[model samples]
Target: MLVYSDDYLEVIHRPASSSCILVTFNEMEMQANGSRFWGQRFCEKADFAALGFISRRPNWFPAASIEKAAAATAAILRQASERILYGHSQGGYAALRYRLLLNADVAIAFCPQLSIDPAAVPFDGRFTRHFAPALHADMEIMPEHAAGRAYVFYDPFHAVDRMHAEWIAEKQRETRLLPVHMTGHGTVRAFAGTARGLALIESCRADDVPGLRALARSVRTGAAMRPYQVALTAIARHPAWADRLSARFGNGFSSVERVNFLYHRANRHIRDGELATARDLLVEAMALQPNNLGPARRLQELDARIVRTSRT
Candidate 1:
């Protein structure tokens, strides 16, 4: 059922007999599909009543403002015994940003940015292109915005995401920072459709911190990102291992992961003083991601070193 629709946002409700209700915020649409409700299938499969907040644009759900968005569905949200706000990335920001406005019992945000406003989080330029003065002027997710307990999941190894999660934890005393390492910016993907993901969600809904801790432990070994992280680490430490893994995995890695492996393996070779081997690896990495500046810059540095070495 369509509860609310506006130029900037759409609210759709999937009714169920359960007393609890999950409110989901949609992430930025990469494909520009008309409008999509996040967690639609999961909600249906779990038989949980849910309200999906869909963004009409990648404007970070600022369309009519949080006040107006909440006002539109105040009565319906108030009727639920338990209200949990959930989303990933952009949607995750909205989950925390509107927790107080929506009177949520809990907020689960995965790899959420504290703010995309350049002035607020200049360290992260990844999403700055999407920032607009009119929409993101008041984009910071403050401590007061989190009405109840909030769980922020992010990879600590990802520098930008680490900063965001740390800032959130520092500002919001009630917020729990859960590190799902090695998933990089795609931390949510580690749990998206798996049994452990479902279990983690159930634990969050029940407010079972111990269970969540146990699940977190299990995730370290079973996460979907584990294999990729392992492969990258192995490649970085032992350049010879790259060829062995490549032969074994055989097209199992995505192009991005392959590029990452090549780049890191090249770095290892450079550290080992194998300039020729590093040059070859970097060239391959550049071939994989022609526009990537990391390998390009490294290749330039390598050329300079070679020139200096020959002169010496």
Candidate 2:
């Protein structure tokens, strides 16, 4: 059922026999194909009723305001005995940001930012372009905004995500930070469809903090990002091993991962004083992902270094 629809946001309701309601928020749409509910499939599988908050763009759910967003669906939300908010990235931000407003019992956020506002989180410029002052004037996810318990799942090794998780934990004493290491910014992907992922979700639903800690302790070695981390580590120590791994699993790597692998390997070569090799690797990476500014910028820097070395 369509609960609410606007230019920027859409709310879809899936009523179940259960008293519990899981409200899901949509992540930033990579392609922006109309409005989409984030966890529709998951909701269909679950016994609980669900409300999916879909964003039209990557505006970070600032279509109107948090108050207005809440008001739009207050009647529907009020019907539920237990409300659990869940989402990843921008959606994750919404889950935490609107917890209190939605009267949620639990919020499960994956790699959610404290704020994309440059003024608030100057260290993280990744989502700055998406930040609009008119819409996101007050983008910070404060302590008081959260209700009941909030579980934040993020990669501690990912510096920006780590900082956000730490800040959220520090501000909200009840918020639990579960570090899913080596998954990078895409921590949610590590547990998607796997037995471990099911266990993590069940633990969150049950509010089992000890189980979550134990699951975290098991660690993630087979995650999608683990290969990239392993490849990068191998590149730094055993170049031959890196080459062998690439030969074995290169086909499985996504274009983004391939580009990243090449970029990091180039950096390793530059550190080893192999500028020409670094340039070749970077050129290959550029060919793979031309739109990526990191490799393009590095290529320019490498050329400048090459020129300076020649002059010297």
Candidate 3:
């Protein structure tokens, strides 16, 4: 049911008889101005009250109406015996930001950024445009003040993400930094790719950190994780493993996986000065996922470069 809607936010609430509540935030989608209730389809089988917040823009937990919403969320959470906050990427940031405000018992954040302010994280340029208006916002305090536990999942090899995780760990003693190697910034994808995401979520709800760790390790070694590792290896400029992986597995990849593999290969070819090969791989990627603007934009750039080279 719709709980709140304004120019800045849209909230949806699904009530259940269970004593537990799962509060979630939505991730930013390409070209989309607003967000939706994330994880509804996945959590349909579970017996918990679900509350999701959707931002109307690519704004962080906007300070404008967060307090009002937090009060309402806290009121709901007070009725439940247990509460968990869950999100990934931009939403992950929100889960952490509001965890203490809602008095959530547990928070599971996948690749969350602690702060986008240049004063705090001047090195990260990935979200410079989004960070511009939020610079003056106070980021000194986080969910660290809460007595509840927080689990942060991120790829240690992802330099920027690693930096953010490390900073968060240093600031918050209640938070645990779990390193998911070679999973890239999309750590949640790594969990879902292997079908172990729900298991991890359940484990976190049970407050079983060891079980969560063991489950994560098992997923890392499973067949489903191979495609993700292969993509990461190729993106890191080592395509030999990607070739070996494809040869062994054959054409068993999903469309999204195929598109990512092709894009990575295109990047490798471009670095090797094989523009034609890069162009062909990118074309294949575009064919697999035509609506994806990332490859579409990159393909246009490649076309312009090829035309310039031909004229010369």
Candidate 4:
């Protein structure tokens, strides 16, 4: 069963019978479709022999409505084999919450935020509207009960990316943190060329992210990876260079080019689920740049949250 809305909220059902279900929130933002849009899109694309042809939209409810969006997913998965969840932005946050609802096979979030509360450390306003309620700290931050495989990707420049990265860093799982230098929040595009990493993520198996390995090797040696600015510029002209550079500089602070770096570093720690390290990094960054109230306020809020959780 699938539901529809004027916005792009939709569900495409298939009898594939894979326990793993993919639920993307406000994926492309849908337009007003008075008729069967998917069928037409499928027909047109399939006619052209386009396997990549899928529906797209440009409108959705605010991010606050993310939790409610999962209702559609929960209903569809009432009968399934295994469940793997994937989403970005509010979709990502909602997937995390919904993962708690089932024995999730894998939960993949591109760049999910922490919360929507005013007191919370925000990613950015535009992102928030799209990801609404999922980012809220009051959100259900559940322990991994399903198969427990999760991948969270973040970009420092984007607010949602920063928040998501921080959350992962503090999550304290034996997670494989993949850091892309100067990569924005949309990683599917960034990692499109990553066959090995893509295969690992899709299959829930890791052999070699030729990307991660080279970075570790360079760190083992004494090589300075490329800078984010240079990498970003090169990516616009030649995406291949970006891919090569991203693999080399997972957590090199030497290229601390923006305010977002603090969050990225903290998030890298969180990816390994070392919340303490993340917290400390947030604090130090906030102290060093007191002019920016976001980090300072967020550090205090997170510390209080940790304390409260510890007491509980």
The alpha-carbon RMSD values of the candidates against the true structure, listed in the order shown, are: 3.2, 2.5, 4.2, 13.7
Candidate 4 segments whose C-alpha is farther than 4 A from its true place: 1-9, 17-19, 28-78, 122-137, 140-147, 156-160, 172-176, 193-200, 203-312
lDDT of 1 by residue, 1-312 (tens): 877776777888888997989899877863223344788888877888898888877778883565676888888898899899998899999888888888888899999988999899989998888898977777798877778788898888778999998987787657888887777777887776646556877888777877776766666666666666666656655656656776677377788887787788788888989999999989998998999998999999999998999999
Question: Quick one: ranking by TM-score, best first?
Answer: 2, 1, 3, 4
Task: Sort every candidate by lDDT, greatest first.
Answer: 2, 1, 3, 4
lDDT of candidate 4 at residue 55, scale 0 to 100: 28
Give the local distance difference test score of model 3: 0.74
Per-residue CA lDDT of model 2 for 1-312, tens digit only, reads 776766677787888997878898888863223444777676666555888888877889883655676787888889888898988999999999888889888899999998899999988998999998988977798878879889999977678899998987888757989987778778877767546645776788788999997886565677777776566668878987887888788778889888988898899889999999999989999999889999999999999999999999
Better of 1 and 4 by lDDT: 1
TM-score of each prediction = 0.83, 0.90, 0.78, 0.48
lDDT of each: 0.81, 0.82, 0.74, 0.48
Comparison by TM-score, 1 against 2, better one: 2
Candidate 3 per-residue lDDT, tens place, 1-312, comes to: 777666667777788887788888777762223334777655565655888877766666575566777766666778888888888877788777777777878888888887777777887877657764643277433645454778999877778999888877777667888877767677777676324656887788777878877876666665454565555565555677766776666377777777877787787877777899899989988998989887888889888988998999
Clashes of 1: 0
Which numbered prediction scores highest in TM-score against the true structure?
2
Deviating ranges (above 4 Å) for candidate 3: 30-36, 129-136, 139-147, 189-202, 223-225, 235-237, 246-259, 273-276, 283-312
- For 205-227, candidate 4 gives per-residue lDDT tens digits of 34244645354333323323225
